[model samples]
Target: MNLTVARLTVRGLLGRRRGILLLVVPALLLVISVIGRSSGSDKHDLAVTILGELSLGTLVPILGLIVGTGVIATEIDDGSIVYLLAKPLPRWKIITTKLAIAVVTTWAFAAVPTLLAGLILYGTQDGLAVGFALGTVVAGAAYSAVFLLLGVVTRHAVVAGLGYALVWESLVGNYVQGAKTLSVQQWGLSVAKAVAADGAIPAHVSLAAAVPLLVVVTVAATAFASVKLAGLTLASDE
Candidate 1:
């Protein structure tokens, strides 16, 4: 991986308005978790609703979109990517460096917040906090790679990522049992179920199925992005 590309990716990510927006979802997760904690409601119910639906279901996908696409989208949009591509660096290295930045930053923004949110809502009961944290981290990494591929392949990366996350995973995955098998959120949920105390979380996919799929998706997306970037052709805006 090219450190220069990685350094540039890091600067571009944190130096934009998107960086400010990145904090919003995690902050919202924490605030809602605090409210749930005080409700004196069923702890499991609160944990499921807060950490399961809101944190993993909502925040993780959104942050993934912003960070994943943000890494390359803005540069591609402004025609600045041509400069980077003009260099002799291997296209795969550039993709790998950017992918690393996206994954790590996404983990910090999504997974850590999910952990904190779980603690606020459930206080390590049933190993729920650690389980959900693991789920989000793994899911966040997958989202980063997939959405980074989207950024490289499509100008409408954010819209595409949102449709998959919200419409496909959140909406359709809920209604269709088979759709859950193909969902990163559900795959990660399986990991959470395995890690948490038995019966603490319900997962539609099995850990055996989820683990291999997660690895395959992440690897395939990164590979495809690298191949696509190697063939990228930047025409003049005018």
Candidate 2:
């Protein structure tokens, strides 16, 4: 992919109204962190739960959905993607470049805020800061790839992504023990388990299962997004 094209796309995706929308998630986390810290109600489990569940599980995925799909689907919808597609760049390169940008942006916005939120809430106890940071990074990257693929393969990417992140993973996993095995939020909690001091954070899934699933989901999503972009078609305005 052309670096110039990627740079331009990144700048545009982050500029204007989209940037405000992207900031909403991290901003919400930080705001809640400030409020929680000031109220003198800070507790270890509460910190762990908030950073673990809300930051990793909810905010990261939402930001990923907005950023990942915003990067390409908006272009596709407005027909500007034709300009990029008409060029001589390899399709895989284009997809890879966009995916990379999405992943990095998601991490910056989601993971960094999570780290700061952790520090604000818990100070330096039980490796909570480190564990939650790592968890956010992994979850953010996976969310980027998954949502990027959604952007390429479907027009209703935001809706579908929200449904999966909110309804399927959050709702179903909460109710069904079997569903926890298949949840990304749970996979991220496993990473938290590895980073946290012993008995500090808890995870339902084991490290053995979570690691492979994280790698596979991220790599597979990236590969599938590349393939989809290679064969991507823009619908006619007719």
Candidate 3:
């Protein structure tokens, strides 16, 4: 990964309005988690609902959309990407560098918070905290890569990403039994189920299926983004 490109991407990502969102969204999760901990509810069930539905199902995807698109989408939209593209930098290096930034940022905002939320709500019972934390790491990475590719390939990356996260993963993946096989959320949940005590967490997709799909989606998205970036041509100013 190119250090210069990584630095610029980081600056661009965190030095804007999107930075506030990254901070606020995770903070909201922590706040709700604190409240959930104090509520007189079934801790395990609360933990499952909060971490499984709110954290993995919701937070990871939203942060993924923000950071993933923020890293490069603005540059691409404003035509500043051509300046970077003109440099003698490999396209794959650019894509990977931005992707790395997105993954780490997503982890910082989503994974860490999810872990904290899990602990707050349920403690270490059944390994739920660590299990869901690991799940966030994988899911966040996949979401970053997928959404970054969306940023590269389309002007409406955020809208497209929201539709996928909201409509596909949140709605269809949750309700449609067969659709769970193709969901990032379910894939991450599978990891959590494997790590947590058996029956502690419910995941529709098996770990065997989830792991391979996670690897495939992340790798494919990064590769395709690189290819697309390599083909990008700056529009001429009249």
lDDT at 218, model 1 = 96
Model 1 C-alpha lDDT per residue in residues 147-208, reported as the tens digit of each score: 99999999999889989988997998767998989998998899999999999999999999
Top candidate by lDDT:
3
Pairs that collide, model 1 = none
How many backbone overlaps does candidate 1 show? 0
Error of 2 at 88 (Å): 1.4
lDDT of 2 by residue, 1-238 (tens): 5687789779878987989988887999999987888775647867977897889888888888888888788887787888888787877788778878888898889889998999989977888988888988888888888998999898999999999989977789656888987888888888988999998888889999998998999889889887777777433322
Task: List runs of model 1 lying over 4 Å from the truth.
Answer: 233-238
Can you write out model 3's per-residue Cα lDDT over 1-238, one digit (the tens) per residue? 8999999998899985878889999999999999999999999999999999999999999999999999999999998998898888888999999999999999999999999999899999999999999999999999999999999999999999999999999999999999999999999999999999989999999999999999999999999999998878533221
Ranking by lDDT: 3, 1, 2
Question: TM-scores of all models?
Answer: 0.96, 0.93, 0.97
How many backbone clashes can be found in candidate 2? 0
Q: What is the lDDT of residue 211 in candidate 3?
A: 100
